[model samples]
Target: MLQPPGALPIRVLVVEDNRDICDNIAAYLEKHNFILDFAYDGISAMHLAVTHAFDVIVLDLTLPGMDGLHFCQKLRTEAKLQTPLLMLTARDTLDDKIKGFEVGADDYLVKPFALQELHVRLHALFKRSNGKAENVLTVGDLTLNKSTLQVHRSGQRIDITPTCMKLLQRLMEVSPSVVTRDTLETLLWADEQPDGDALRSHMYKLRQAIDRSFEQPLIHTVHRIGYRIAEDM
Candidate 1:
């Protein structure tokens, strides 16, 4: 199978109850330069899938506690995650596969499949998910190129610090949606957090860089809630 197009590793979440299957897939995919995260059951998988971003999700249909169908439904509807999901199941019936797609599975793979086939399918799914957009993130005229780390607004190039860029990327990724202060803090510092409004200080620097010169002011504070990148829709 071909490696995903990029210098960064392809992040994959494999949600399978079968230990043997998980090990087998991990051994092969890891050799082929793919980063994999595993969850034995659906409940923990749901938490991982919602909280973390992955290039593709390889999910088995029969899972304990939550089951793949319900997990997929909640991931799509409740979490609003558009990550590509591929279902692995022994059920070969058309109805079973249809149910998988109806619940927002991007592709289906039957059990006892070859490891090579799974790799190929996953690469394809990742390509399809990232098609056309080509690693460029945009909120209004502000564009941040993932590959280049370049930011531009209103046809003018804007210089952004790496720290500010991280904050900008998160806000733009979920544009128009309030991203809580807690969430941003977790993303920025993880467990070894800085004390006393360090996040607010960085946010202030970011705002001055991205919004001070622009008239339309895209970044908005939600007033005790968090921040968002939007143009007042």
Candidate 2:
């Protein structure tokens, strides 16, 4: 499905062998509300990559089992998955970057990197995946224009925050499927999933902005599960 920009918080698989670095990345990402999954070796990375869907992957060059280059090749050649890859390596050379790209890496970051830069790079990777622009979104009088992040109901435009827009977009895209609270929080917060009642508060705000003003409520609570947007509602 074509998820709107920021519709889901970027899911990142951190494939690094260094325990310290892996923990650091996980901590940083969690602080940002990203649902971070980890793999310390190339084989495991490949397995996770193939089995689960990720918005972007942060791969290390020196991984156990298969190396990053080989893993990238396998992903492109064998798996045929085009998920964006951000390569991380201690080998900061022109040839290294070139080789990574030659395989299938969408972007590269040399080790001893800044946390901020990694964040920016991940953002860039996913934005590029979506052609880096907001256009229009349709989900059964409910229409959204991504460029402006605006929603419409039967031609009536409604103003919404970027967060609400994202929530609605995801719900609409996966209509009828229960979106778990964790999943929705992961999509909205990214590495920064909230604790306590914060997520519930956001959902309330989103419902108020979109569904409260309309008839035939599109957003529905799934009872002990999460939430879903019903086009038929």
Candidate 3:
């Protein structure tokens, strides 16, 4: 990973066993002003995905150790990583494409494809990823921007921790609707159940950060229920 000046550049990991193809891709993309990293097998690709942050990954389906489908599954199910994946495979059948999609590949390209087409597909994938509606909720004089993972309020931005963001997102989603304690915990922790007071501690911090600054507190605790974010006092 080449660390350049200014904001982080979009990183790409190309996983292909063919040295010629890997060299060609690295050379071509480097010319187009992109940071490229190479991994020869699915195991190495999985390691790179887990260790480093990447904007996109060009994965080959038939790889030693773990195969592309299994790798994609691990990234989504185990790592919970959402980096866009462009699958490269010789299996050009409709079934192959369907299976790739089912395994979380953002795009697929058969072998004997042009480098230009690959570039275009990667460009489209990046555009789609950035163009998606990531942020979904906002309250009175408050804004929750998911892209930057930030929360702003009253023309001034308020810093929200990651845990609070999760809690706040749920609160904002069912705005005006009461979020029960059980529901809140399920939404925040999900599968892993924390201590009984864990939710309370997080909620208190979120409310303090969001509501304490403003006169009209937007976060309302509903008795035995949970919480709600409302513009109306």
Candidate 4:
């Protein structure tokens, strides 16, 4: 579905046996608006992974019934899911990480790690799994030409401010996935927060240029969360 980034909650399958670790992960991710499903064992994790489509999966190495290596192997070979998987393990040895990768794990994270780091890693894996970077990013009729730094919708050119162009670039780059307001704000304004509702003002201008004249509005606001560029609301 190309949900590389999201205004929608990033669906994550958390496979871990440790209650404390699961609790911590849940708390942290939920605060960031991530939708999480927990599995205490490898069998349960495999079932959930196979059934649901997730942006990423956090798997623990030491698991009852299946184990992370076996689970990763079965997911790739048996279920045939190419979902991004981040291996979580207490074992930080080179061999342990290599073994994980050999079995189809995309990335690795050691235990006793920062929650923020985990979040960042998951975002990276999700983007990589979908479409890392393309010169032209297209969502339906709307397109952003990175090389020339231009925006177009249905053959019509969109002349916008540099700030608005940056906004459109970002939104189109992560099309189908809603980009959160906080994310957009950070991208535009960085740590120095805008004086007052500057993002909203800019977004209004963007919508006018990109959507107001079009029959089908390509830019959409995702309520209190953020904005996205998609054919569908």
Candidate 5:
């Protein structure tokens, strides 16, 4: 699935041993609006995968200490994680693919593959596992439904444009944590931010829609940092 511009970026964990390949994947995926965390070894990959929630994991079959097969086995049996795992390696034999699947890989892709194909396969795995991307996100009394593309505050429906809806979704996804201006701009505009106070203007409109009628305010400015969505004391 081709993600529309301004859509929430999918968080990905990339476990590859080759530094050059890793850098190339990072550059390509980030440009396509996928947030990434890297790990060069199976041990480190397992640590990062268990600690953070990732939309998908791209793992290499060969590693320094632990290999990808063992990593997948441990992830499924020990961690009990159901996150989509895409095995990337040079092993393309029927036995290799079967082994990967037995160890809990959702998809397998050989080396020397096109980045576009990787992107498409990742989305396919995500969709198959998640069964549609719409999720109802909530922060305190505020609610945003991803499937319905609707926003509500304190049980009252609020009208917001698509731009405002994206901004609100980002803030609510990381509720109670400040979302810096740079990060917000990257998510919203994908490196093509407009001049002047466009973000501020949209933020003003969002605040009005979300807080204008409520007694307690939820959106807050963190001085020179960024903005967060949380109930005020």
Candidate 6:
């Protein structure tokens, strides 16, 4: 898969009870620069999925404690997580695949699959999910394409890390309105924020990317309140 320069590694959760299978998947995925978290059962998976942000989920259909179908249902209907889910199962029947889809699985793969195939499918799912939002956000001379994850200012392309992209997206989405520090922190880290000035550090980098070289600054600090992006610096 093609990643933007300095882009963050894809975050993935693998929910499978089989230790051997999880190990194999982890080894292969890590080799490809993916950051993976493991959950041996659906219960723990649900907790992780609810509390943290993930780019995708690789769910095993026969997971212990809650099973994949129920876990998918809970995430979609109750927890409201829209993270792409790829179901892994030993059953290859048409009914089984239909059930998986009905329960909110974005893709499915039968057991004894090749690791290469798994990687391909995961890349496809990530691409599909990102392409869902076709809207391009603009604030002043800065423009961000949500579908392509491209950012340009004054008609020049700007390289940005994924975190910076997210921060810019949020600020541009609510241009001229202050986005609270708490809200930006939640957007960046979910429930796992790091200590002391981390948000400031990121905001500084974002400002540098979008404002440092430009003639007029589009991002403004709201003085202990938050930050806002507008035409007037």
Highest TM-score, which number? 1
lDDT of 4: 0.84
TM-score of each predicted structure versus truth: 0.77, 0.55, 0.58, 0.55, 0.57, 0.59
The lDDT values for all models are 0.86, 0.79, 0.80, 0.84, 0.85, 0.86
Candidate 5: residue 159 lDDT (0-100)? 91
lDDT of 2 by residue, 3-83 (tens): 354566779999999999988887776766468899989988877876567889999999899999999998787555678
Give the CA lDDT, 0 to 100, for residue 97 in model 3.
Answer: 97
Better of 1 and 2 by TM-score: 1
Reference-based TM-score, model 2: 0.55
Candidate 3 lDDT (Cα, 0 to 1):
0.80
* Model 1 lDDT on a 0 to 1 scale: 0.86
Worst 10 residues of 3 by lDDT: 1-10
User: Between candidates 1 and 4, which one is better according to TM-score?
Assistant: 1
Query: What residue runs in model 1 are displaced by over 4 Å at the alpha carbon?
Result: 1-9, 42-53, 62-67, 70-74, 77-80, 91-96, 181-183, 190-199, 223-225
lDDT of 5 by residue, 29-116 (tens): 8888789999999988887776567989999999987999999998787555678999999999999999999999999999988998
Output the better candidate (5/6) by TM-score. 6
Candidate 6 is scored at a TM of: 0.59
Regions of candidate 6 where Cα sits further than 4 Å from its true position: 1-5, 133-233
Per candidate, the number of residue pairs that clash is 0, 10, 0, 2, 0, 0
Model 5: how far is 95 from its true place, Å? 0.2
Better of 4 and 5 by lDDT: 5
